[model samples]
Target: MLKKAIGGSLAAMLLAGMVLGTDALSYVTTACGNVREAVKSEITPEFELDRIRNEIDKLMPEIRQHMTVVAEQSVDVKDLQREIAKKDTKLASQRDAILALRADLSSSKDSFTYRHVSYSRGEVEADLANRFESFRNGEEALARDRQILAAQKQTLRANQKKLDSMLGRKQELAVHVSQLEARLKTIQASEAVNAIEVDDTKLSRVEGMIKDLNHALDVRESILETEGNVLGRIPVEEDSVDLHADVVSEVDQHFGLTADENVAEAAQSDSL
Candidate 1:
């Protein structure tokens, strides 16, 4: 009975040890799986960080090259702007110079003067004096035309008086014709007719004189009508004045230099 009890207790102790061993084996297996999962999760993040670092390292040279190109383009743009500014300044200056020349030409054209009349009659120290005398002579001639016109009017008046006399004589001749008709009715004698013929010859001579006087009066009236128009018939010295003005204009156009206000203002605006 003691040996059987000892064997039963040994069997119980062996079963307990077998159960503890199984429990320990399951715990070790579960802990090992948890440790493996943790290690996998930790190593995954490290691998991702290393991949990103390598990619960045590979792209560094290309990024630096692109940045360098950008820097160089910026410098080129600055230089181009400076050159454009310089060209614009030079063009403005040239335009201002051209404007100044135009202004000077305008000023010179305004300033020029030309002499209209000049005279030197045999070097009598009378350039202006001779011209003045010529002007005076023209005035004198105009005055003379007035005087001659007055004289011609007087002659016209005299001719008109003679025409009046001729008109009276014509009326008298009509009266004599009526008287002869009456005499023809009253008396018819050859000797009396010869006496009438002599009287007729005298009347005919008076009629001829009247015709001449009327013609003379007409000529005198025509002379008086033409006297006022004589001034219009005088010639003008157009070539001299035109030549002088053209010469002065050409000289001013070629050699003058004067600036305008608008050009100066433009230059100032460009500088600003």
Candidate 2:
């Protein structure tokens, strides 16, 4: 279908160009190239590979048929060889018999004997002439057959080589296709790997929230410590004041201690 479309497009372009005049011919090459590129672009690698594989498969039957023909030809060549060998043996015997008959005739023999049957010189001569004629014809026929056999063998060798070449090419194509498939798989896998993505936006927001909460907690703890330190201190007066003597005497009287008794005891002790 694509081939037909391309062909149609090319025809239309050619027709249009013809209508436009010789000046349009300059653009034909460029237009054809563009069309070819467009066709190539539409053909995917996988589809092309499949097409190649199918073509390879389609060749198999023809190859097998050729193989069958070659095999049959091989058998025919062998059979012809055997036939030629038999003919060669028969010709050798006939040649020896002809030579023997000529020798007999050369001796001026008036009669010849064959299996106890007798023949005059004339009869032997006639038989020799006929045998010679038959031998010549047989030799010619054998030569022709030999030529045909040689040609057939040559053709078979060439064909066998062709088959071998085809088989080798098919193997190479199969291996190449496998390699292409594996490479394509690797590329697709890489693309899949490349396609993977991680969205860290929400994760980053959550992390920010956690950090803010930590900071707030730390600030609150710092504020509490500061307030406790400020409020837990003992209030003290900076100025030093002398205690009132009356207050001291009343404090001493409350504890039942007399300052005059203590002073009298201390004076008596000092005099002793």
Candidate 3:
């Protein structure tokens, strides 16, 4: 009887040990599963944040490059406008010179003609003939100068047209660039908001980049506005002055006087 009781007690102890060991193992497995799920959840967001950060990094240089292009274009337009103004001034001066020469020849021819008709056989007549020849040569030279001025005016008009066309093209490019920048800003804003919960530090960095880009764009826009105003303010045509010059030129040409001088006088008067 003592042996049997001892055997039964040993069996009971062994069974209890087995049950405890099984319960411990089950608890360890459940904890391991929960830990793995938590690690997986954390890893996904981290990976996503890293991806967004990389995308932003790649985009920054492209944005900067585009901004640089806009700045360069603005500078080019300003230079072209300055050149146009210089050409216009040169053209006006040339026109004025032609008109002045025309006037002097006309007065001299009139005086020579009066002397020739009133005293045909004297030293005064010989002097008058020489004066007439001088006046005729002067008138022919003025005609050549007037032709050169016309050619210069045509060249200036062509240059102005070319510059205006370039300006228009640049304006179109600016508008397109602005639109693209706006779209990029919207995308960055959305991405930034999404990243806020996952990584605050990275979000702050992206926000900084966005602020810098915006500041650069603002500066470029201001420059474009100022240049536009300055260039647009200059008139391409002074129609009233041009019309008066044309009328004076016609009168001189019709009266067989030197029209170059008339053209110059009219241009000078119009300048005032």
Candidate 4:
């Protein structure tokens, strides 16, 4: 509105200046006669004024349209603000109602406890003690498994070494048997064949020993793998206790930490 007023004032001043200037020029020209006609021929004041008025006329409709839209928008904005204020008031009232309901629900809930489960001081203490006992048992079991794992690992190493020794001996025996067979092949004379006539008992025994060694190693390895599974996820010192500790920590973190507080609360409730 202020901008429009200023622009209108400027246009009015321009129009006024044009009119007054043309009249003054006309009066001067009338007094000067032919000199004024020459000036008039140069200026064409009427034509300039007519052109300015035509341009102003073209702009006026657009200005009026802009003003009309602005007025409508202002009314719409005021209505929107009123609507928003009403909604805000409604929300405030609803918030208060919700607060009141929550208080009532809390009071009712406190009284509702009389209808169901109650705990004694002894029971609550016993319950937590059981959890503690279970936790301790889990730790002890984990440690014992670790010890057993270490012992069995040592036993496995010993068995593996013994099995290797048996395998080495069997290999030596096999090579000796191959040499004997080659030597017999070299002998062409019947007397030489007769001299070399011997059973492969030692070779059979060595092969048997090799087979037994392999079987024993396989069994030992299987036992170790099974024991590893039982010991749980690798590195018994860390992983074995992780699950138990996590569970206990979660319970401790969530429940009130001080056992004394629980016992006291139970005692107070029991007295009531």
Candidate 5:
């Protein structure tokens, strides 16, 4: 109902715009274009394919009608051709009879005999004149019939060609529709395969939390080693000895003094 109302409103606006001015009409056209695009967005490929199939189905009845018409026309053309052939044979016989009578009259005969009946020259001439007139009229009628047959044959050929073209186009459209449906299915399948549900925000938070935990653990380990002073520095014997305390001991050893405290006093007394 809402969609219908919106459509009605759009149509009313378009009519009003068209009645107003070209600029308003242009605006209405743009609005309709936007609506058209919106409608197109909602229409799926499957729906369009179904519509195409329905349209193709509709054409079947019309094509069948055309086929029927062409078939009837073909029958009619064949009948006409047979009729023309029979007339042509009859006309040929009539023409030969006329030519024979003319040939007999040209010989200056006073009378003529035909089928064991003798007729005077006047009777023969009158009979020949009537026969020739009849033949002429028949030839004219046959000529007209031949023309009609030719035209009918041409019409039948055209109708047959049109029918063939329609059938061919129908087949092509069916194949094209099938191809489109197959391609649409392949694309849908690919999209379904490629679509993965993953939350980027959650994944990023997890990575950040792991990094922060590692940093905190490293800082705590460093603090513990510094406070305990256990294996904090390299173990060496040189670090254990005090350099200031060793200086007097090194001097006493070099001088070979037995009493380090009395050496200086004894040297002073000896000097005195």
Candidate 6:
């Protein structure tokens, strides 16, 4: 809205106040007041717009960072899902293979029933070695798959946590943006220019707050390499009992073979 110019009527009204009739002076007073109102109306929107711009600028970087994570997480979740599917298929295949091997081993041990030649000891031993070796290999492979799945799940969980945290922060920042927008919509500017000066001070304070918030967000460094590792299983250490030590001690105690005693006994025998 165009602010009506308050030309010289305000000064004229004050100077002519003592001589002018009450009705004419009242008209001049009202005109000056309308012009002030119009100017105030114009300034208010600009003030609010400036404030909103400052606030939005403060929040945009963090909001954009979270948005980036949201997109990345979408891709990560899909990849994890694919990996789980592949693992499940491989696990099932290995398990089926183990079952088949077990059946073959068991059936090989059976006596002759219907045109079946029973396996001899050598054949049975060979079959056992084959079946057991396959079973061990399959079990080890399955265990590795389980470990990989566990690590993947751990990674997924970490990513999910970060996603949730970022989403929450985004929501909070969005609310702040909306509030500033609403404030702009309803603002009323003061007629005094000093009021604008005070607001400019407030703008400075708001800028400082934005700086503090930005610093806080900047300092929030994330933990690196969230994925876990599958460590190879180590054998447990224990104290080992040595039977040879006991046997050697017992033999030494029983023999009592002193060199001086043996020499004296041999001398006595030589004399005899």
Give one digit per residue, the lDDT tens place, for model 1 in 1-272: 99999999888667756877767556657878999999878775336545645654565575556556555655655565565556556555655544544444444242322266333332223333454455456555555655655565565556556555655655665566556555655564654676664577888999999999999999998897678468575434333358786875686577562346546766999999
Model 6 per-residue lDDT tens digits across residues 1-272: 13334546565666677567667668777888999999878785557667766775676687577667656766665676676577567657756755654566565454322237665645555655775676577667657766765776676677668767766776776687678667655553334433554567888999999999988766653212122122433324446679998876676578895657768878999999
Ranking by TM-score: 2, 5, 6, 3, 4, 1
The residue-by-residue lDDT of candidate 4 on 157-190, one tens digit each, is 5655655565565566556655655554565356
Better of 3 and 6 by lDDT: 6
Off-target runs (Cα >4 Å) in candidate 2 are: 1-42, 202-272
Cα-based TM-score, every candidate: 0.24, 0.59, 0.29, 0.26, 0.59, 0.34
Of the two candidates 1 and 5, the one with more favorable lDDT, higher being better, is 5
Kindly indicate the candidate among 4 and 6 with the higher lDDT. 6
Q: What are the clash counts of all predictions, listed in order?
A: 3, 0, 9, 0, 0, 0
lDDT of each: 0.59, 0.90, 0.64, 0.62, 0.88, 0.65
Arrange candidates by lDDT, descending. Answer: 2, 5, 6, 3, 4, 1
Q: Given candidate 2, what's the lDDT at residue 144?
A: 93
- As for TM-score, the candidate ahead, 2 or 3, is 2
User: How do the residues 22-140 of candidate 5 rate in per-residue lDDT, one tens digit apiece?
Assistant: 68867778888999999999998889999999999999999999999998988988898888889889889988988988899898889998899999999888988998999899899
Q: Candidate 2's error at 110, in angstroms? A: 2.0
Worst 10 residues of 3 by lDDT: 112-121
Residue 30's lDDT in candidate 6:
86
**Which runs of model 6 end up more than 4 angstroms from their true locations?**
1-124, 189-272
What does the lDDT come to for candidate 6?
Answer: 0.65
User: For model 2, how does the per-residue alpha-carbon lDDT over 133-236 read when each residue is reduced to its tens digit?
Assistant: 99999999899999999999999999999999989998998999899999988998998999988679988999999999999999999998779769975435
Specify the poorest-scoring 10-residue window by lDDT in model 5: 230-239
Better of 3 and 4 by TM-score: 3
Model 5 per-residue lDDT at 172: 100
Taking every candidate in turn, the Cα RMSD to the unseen true structure, in Å, is 75.9, 15.7, 53.5, 63.4, 12.8, 46.8
**Candidate with better TM-score, 1 vs 6:** 6
